[model samples]
Target chain A: MSINEKDELLYNMENRDVETPQPRVKRGGVHRPFLFGFATALCLVYLMDLGFEAYKFATLRETVQVASGELQTSWPPPPPYTEVARVARYVVHISDWASLATISTAAPIKGFPFANTASVSDGPVGLSSGTPYFYISNLDFTGKDLLTDARTTVSLSEAQSDYCHTSGFDPEDPRCARILLSGSIVEVKNGTEEATFARTALFSRHPVMKTWPIGHHFFFAKLNISHIYVLDFFGGASDVSVQDYYKATPFP
Target chain B: MSINEKDELLYNMENRDVETPQPRVKRGGVHRPFLFGFATALCLVYLMDLGFEAYKFATLRETVQVASGELQTSWPPPPPYTEVARVARYVVHISDWASLATISTAAPIKGFPFANTASVSDGPVGLSSGTPYFYISNLDFTGKDLLTDARTTVSLSEAQSDYCHTSGFDPEDPRCARILLSGSIVEVKNGTEEATFARTALFSRHPVMKTWPIGHHFFFAKLNISHIYVLDFFGGASDVSVQDYYKATPFP
Candidate 1:
């Protein structure tokens, strides 16, 4: 039969109830003809559907294979450094204020504990002009903390103003900036020229140093500059330039 | 003296310029006093800023620590499959024709060596009961290509009449439905009872199968089921149940 004829036949069979045999079957007897015809129609339709689905699956597999092969053969290796540099610059933010700390060690002892009181400055090298200075009393706990430990970290950023009303200050008013230089305290001996030069520099840079009283020992703590972290509202610096500036030296 | 008195004295000294001294020369340089005063002010401000920053950092650090601890302790375990079954009835689109192929052992397969044939269907699962069967001969290269690589994909979706016209068919005709299936051929098997059974199951649930022929010794090739996309324009198969009705029996 032609394709059209075959389809018509199937369609007719699908709509019609199956014809029974010449002898009448019992009323409750299985509706055998209907069941058979329905089953046959369902089977035909299902087989046809599978045929179509298989066609679709095969086509996609071939496309994927071809595309994958083309990808494997393509060219110049991708750039490496460009991506890394892009990521580094994307992480910097800014605010205000910072604290810096460094490690200090005396001659006899090694790996002393951390001390919290010391003046930290970003100023001139040695006793030169424009040197930054910090002043702390010898009796302060931070000073004692610094005496044992030379290495320290300084944090820089803004203060949260959540309790200005309770503290009797206007929330809008700017608060004092705080800088903590923590490291071991070293006494500048009377006759040591190098230590004296350093002491002179510190005194010149800070008015408080000159008035701190005569004969009071000024110990110059050697700074362990490597452990410094200059954290601003912006992220901390890992590069050497910011570290050296905090240490008040060209080199550690 | 009060803090105001000390400040006035410093301001007066700061405004003065240095001159040649007579009996005993001044120990410090001409700019020393000014530098000292400025450095002292800076140091105070810097220290204050540092304190504020430290407090902020400590607070943030504590918060993060607590949050991390909580997260670690309160993570939920894996969910049961019962949750997955809740949304299982959403209909997924399948193409009009799904070609199935049996991979030919004789071909030297490079990427995909399977030889197959393409079959087109009227709708998603299979042909509907009353739809006319369109003759899609293997003689057509589109049909031929699909048979060669049973892996093909076809889409039956709404499109502008122009697109349908480009496919060499009249889009204006009510009987016309957009059918696009492309895939590679996997295999071509002889018509058999087992094959008939498998085909019935594949097609009954699939709208496309109803329009295709059955019980004919025709090419049965595997379809590329992955990435089967469909867009139905005449709203075909929307009312058809998507349940796996043919799961137990060979035919639905």
Candidate 2:
């Protein structure tokens, strides 16, 4: 059609009033086909919503189903308690932050065991490297403490996530699970292959770390993981030998 | 009115067809008054929904607002960096759990700084005691560690909540805030006033603590705050005198 004719047709389509065909009844504004199309679109949208909800429910099943409240995305159901080493690694792998305990050399409270919260990574999302890496600056107490004494214990807990809260397990409850990696925490030298891997592992989980101010003297450090301890059941703490802990896969 | 007459009237009200009057058109069915009533009801419901949403946003402001992302209930905007004591108390008061650092006497890593996750309460919600109380059992390594040496430091972070993460602050970033209350963690003598307060402080936040196994020998313990250190700004850590820390109010 010519441009003027096409424009005229478009205007008619946009501005024309829908006609109702009933002989006696007055027109109710909306056309029948348009109403039918709207209803069909609603049904399609509803089905898409249901599909999306189902997808969310399936992928986020890590969230526990609590008896009396809203659901939360949870860590993978902790491995069977009998699989001690696997449970330990599961706690380590899911935790993005850990508490590093170091002997303080700072004055007054000098020589005391000081705990500092440190963001950590074992590896990226699906890959568990079995070693906890830290992005720390010398200005912080934990970093300063490490400068004086490298001995530290990195603590990870299932309580960090919604798992324990939704499951009704107290943070201190052994059933809630806690993992401790004890050893010397030493800084990885710049330009080393391990440092590169540590950067990927940490920055992937905490993207904002890369933008931190350079004046803080941030460096990559890791736990030597000489000893492993896990609390996952009623009986007491479990000791997972370092050898077995490294061999176990957190994701089953 | 007679029962039958009242019933007949109710039936007419319920079953009568709504009449729409017009000049040349046949009945269009719905009554004008009924339509007006439905529209008014819808308006009221919409207003109530808006009010409820506003209430939720106001009451749960602890979650932070980031430049890009869904809004979250933020913690009270953190105190200025200059208010060192208030900032320290703020971290301790809002945190329901903390990482306790103790010198381990456990066999494998004897004499190492071991960190354990502990559910802590400074006081019930809105009541800041400035002292962290713990519901710990002897079965856990922390309990055993306490038995050997009471010297410990309780570490807390704003990162424990969604505030830091949502605000894009890395957990280790000093601006994200960390508080270390250094002192001895000692058990309160049973049946004392302090022990009763400690129970209220802990169980109020962690209701499940009341149901933990009885054989575990759980007891109430408090951190005797001797030194307070807060890392909230770029320069380095700030020390809030113990007296000043107790005097400051977290919620202002």
Candidate 3:
């Protein structure tokens, strides 16, 4: 060993003796060996406890199971049922798709009220306009229905989400919440500012719409909401004014 | 020690000596102390491994997570998309609730197409009738609309279940599957056999309907399906005849 290293080892040994005072073992007094052993055992137990927690964290990650297709992610709680306007708007804002009902113009079942599954957006993410926009093709049934009769109603249910189903509330339960938007779906005039905004709103929510075939004669249309119907609680449906619906923020 | 125990101990020692031949450690043979230490270490490692596995299993039980509202349970995989009739029936059979669209007779928004969330059932559990039954009251918007015009459409989507969302499919995507049943809503005559069956079907699927106020004059109704529209694949929607839709088993 080098001379300096040898000196450092001697100093460390001397310092250790000074730091840990010698224990006394006498009748009616604490025993040094027993106390030392107990302290060592406690440290070992603390280390094992920490190791178990780390192991549990790893286990949780490995055992994560996806239920119904809903990833285990957290979202804001829904608004209370008393806020009819807010609940109505919240349903529209959160849903990516809904049932669009229109008077059919096509044959076989012409003039009947037809409901088709449609994807829609109120506005771009984080911007709730209370207006539902659609990107539809003239070739599809809903598109054909829209072209023939502009009058339509979009139906949205909290049941469409895990919200009601998981809460043990039946989809039809008033507390589960349902919204119906009745209005005329008008095609935005091409090249208009509203049309541009509609495209941005619909495409941002449904990215695949951007790559849809052009030959299908797809066009942008929006629901000019006239009347709002909300069923959020037991007393029956309420018709909220369009102005109040617009004034209320869905975030509330 | 007792004479008999002393003799047994002596026998055991002699047997052990005979069973375990002494290792020659003159220079190149195995050493006793080293072998004993290694064996003891191996035993401790095995016990630790077993303890770790038990700990992991306990951790898994404690950390179970519920996603969306879907309880972690196993369900059969959906039928292939090409089975148009089967897919249509499957969408109807699997859905517990759907969007019921009807022509409105109420004033203000009267004569407009109105969509309402309705809970429906095809038949009692395990009996797929390919026909949807409803429990409606004249007090509700849907019931009032039905009183005016019986023509309606019930829209069902695989999106209602976690199937589409968990599979990364948008609700509007054709592969997500949607069914539109266009038909006339006819009330089952009260006190008749059909009414009895309708009540059984509707009540079984939606238990909450049983507790709905009797004052609302809730009555049973069924859709006399005339046409079926199914969109389950990338191609355009298919027009499946009502006959084929009934003939195909949803289980297939």
Off by over 4 Å in 3: A1-74, A190-193, B1-75, B191-193
- TM score of chain A per candidate: 0.32, 0.75, 0.71
Ranked by TM-score from best down, the candidates are 2, 3, 1
lDDT of 3 by residue, B85-200 (tens): 98887767767888999998778789889888888888775577888988888998989898878889888888776677556677778888889899989888999988888888
Candidate 2 regions off by >4 Å? Answer: A1-59, A63-77, B1-77
Q: Encode model 2's per-residue lDDT on B1-252: one tens digit a residue.
A: 999999998987776654433343223554343344445545665687699999987765654421101111235777887899999888887776789999999999999999988888888777889889998787778899988889999988776665665455666667888898999988889999989989998877777787777887889989998898889977778888999998999878
> Candidate 1: which stretches are off by over 4 Å?
A1-137, A155-190, A214-216, A232-252, B1-252
lDDT of 1: 0.29
> Best candidate, TM-score-wise?
2
Please report, as a residue range, the 10-residue window in candidate 3 chain A with the lowest summed lDDT.
Answer: A64-73
Writing each residue's lDDT as its tens digit, candidate 1 over A1-252 gives 999999998877876565433433223553334344445545655687699899976654332110010011111111122222111111100111122222213222122111121233323222222122344444432344455543343322112111212222221111211112222234444477645555654443333445444444445433332222222211212222323443332211
Q: State the TM-score of the second chain for every model.
A: 0.25, 0.73, 0.70
Quality class of the docking in candidate 3, CAPRI style = incorrect
Candidate 3 structure quality by residue, lDDT tens digits, A144-227: 887778888888887766666556678888888889899998888899998888888887777778778889888888889998
Who is ahead in lDDT, 1 or 3? 3
